[model samples]
Target: MGVHGTVAAGFEGVREEFSAFLTDEEHAPGAQLVVHQGGERVVDLWSEGVGGESLLGVFSSTKGAAYLVTALLVQDGFLDLDRTVASYWPDFAAEGKGGVTLRELLAHRAGVIGLDAGFTAEELADDRAIAARLAGQRPFWQPGRFFGYHAFVIGALVGEVVFRATGRTLQECYEERIRAPYGLDLWLGLPQSQEPRFLSTLPMLPTPEQAAEIEAAAASPYSLGGIAFNEHAPGNGELYDFPNSRAVRAGGQASAGGLGSARGLAGMYAAAAFGLNGRAPLLKPDTAAEFARIHSEGTDLVGGMPKAFGLGFQSYGAHFPVLGAGAFGHSGASGSLALADPRQGFAYAYTRRRYAFPGGAAPENTRLLGAVVRALT
Candidate 1:
């Protein structure tokens, strides 16, 4: 099926790139792409199997919202990055993580990647439960010595602090200060009324060679990476199915349960960095820079790849050549990518219903993003 949407006059290249990407895929991706120049949406498009407004699981891209909320709280002086996790949630000190500061946790250096006993599906569905269980767990590495991807629990770790400091859940903070104020389509806690718009994320259809590679590279379920992704849990469902559960979406796990369309992702970033809907930017210039600054780099212990992060956000500029050094955001397992390039004066988001091979941001993003830059120039 042909792509359906509108692109501002100068952004026709983006449409071409999007169409070409769909044509190249062996299976339909059910993708949505949106970009905002300051507060103006320059491109809005979707493909077969989904509508432009349909919400899909955004996986770790939800972490971008979690981090953005943290940044706003810091900007308002409600939370201090230098404070120890134990200072906020006292039980966090039960482990050797007493010295681990909010900054260290945001950088993925607190080292409590997962529990010695993996979380059950019910516990994993609740952020507070995840935090409660992990609070007394030991760090995989010496706290503050190294950084790795928290994968499924960063939101809970951070959210616990948010609650202890402000008597509010991160999801509550996000909805009140960010989502509801701007009327963003993204939701940490999806309501029953929005159920009809959500499309279940389809599993990846990897080629034979890709499947072989995946099997060859598979880590033991008990390995650190496995634990981080909750693969070690007995009878745990596939990662792709996490958000499909009404319980997961209702509780709003925060780490990966976010559901929204590309427009919502784009608008959130636009509001945070560029002031969407003619409102003042949610974050100050200094706050944005601090979160965008590189906090960790080099091979990740959990992902086993060269990765970089800034406060809880991925340093997208390092991964996407078309973006500026200040571009910060996150990607999800369903090949979703959303970010704000403050230096470039734009925010971009792409969400796909079908899981992309290799399980991360879809490779087509580079081509699409390059096309956007070309159009802007």
Candidate 2:
């Protein structure tokens, strides 16, 4: 490929290793992976195939953006985690969910996993309609019974909370308060003009030979692309590819769909690791602490593993070590991952077109990041 940027301060050897990782043809399509140490840009690297301006789909990594939205509302004193969802949106209590707390929803403990089968893609386009549908819908499991990853519903649930607390939708509020202020290129509902720039996510439908080849590889939900799996099948599902997808996209749903550039994503977390404008914190210290707190522990409904989750982001463990306990970020469908490690004062975002294991190509990426972190530390 052509010339990519270099690492800045504390991350010297990291950039060199990242450069070697980028050269892997299997890891290509392209990506931008950046790491910040002590609130300073240390490793800033972007490969050529993944241009700086290209907005590749970051899959579920969008959840990190969603977490930022909820955290901001909490910071502004508009939304309280301990408060019930019904406090902001009255209809949220229509069903047995009247008692579901914002924190429960944030931590993916909300029993409302999927919407009613009657729910349609058209309804997802209208925030009001979807919110109403969700408010009156019954829980997939008993509220607080246990945590199951609410894949698609997590976005609408969190976004609606932000909306009820603030007059603006998650997308609008995020842009004005977060992305715009930081000059980040991340977006939830990408506009039509920019849609062309978005690299549509390709399902990791392994070829017959590949599928059989990897049958014994592992049985991870993410490995099977479970949560990472897209249900764009013909049904009364949400309109994922609608021309007006931007409206729903504006909601900043963590799961279904969101868009942005790798660098832009790196920068957002970069701002989190560092401060935005001097003294202006993206999340209050307490809130940031909570952002990485694990609220639930059980077999993730989607990932089908013993996983833990904070308010919105996933942490490091058997599944991902690149994201340590102190780190908070999310992985998207395909092979996109983003996170912030306060312990190391580091943030990294990587995006690529290739969709490999749903459990993520983390093992491989971890090898790459381990080298990076070793250098930074």
Please, what is the whole-model Cα lDDT of each candidate in the order they appear? 0.92, 0.67
Candidate 1, clashing residue pairs? Answer: none
lDDT of 1 by residue, 145-175 (tens): 8999999999999999999989999999999
Q: Candidate 1: what lDDT?
A: 0.92
The number of residue pairs in model 2 that clash at the backbone is 11
- Candidates in order, TM-scores: namely 0.99, 0.84
Candidate 1 segments whose C-alpha is farther than 4 A from its true place: 24-29
Per-candidate clashes, comma-separated: 0, 11
Worst 10 residues of 2 by lDDT: 221-230
lDDT of 2 by residue, 81-144 (tens): 8999889888888768888899898887777765545446656555456666778878766787
Error of 1 at 152 (Å): 0.5
Among the numbered candidates, top lDDT falls to 1
Provide the lDDT at 152 for model 1: 92
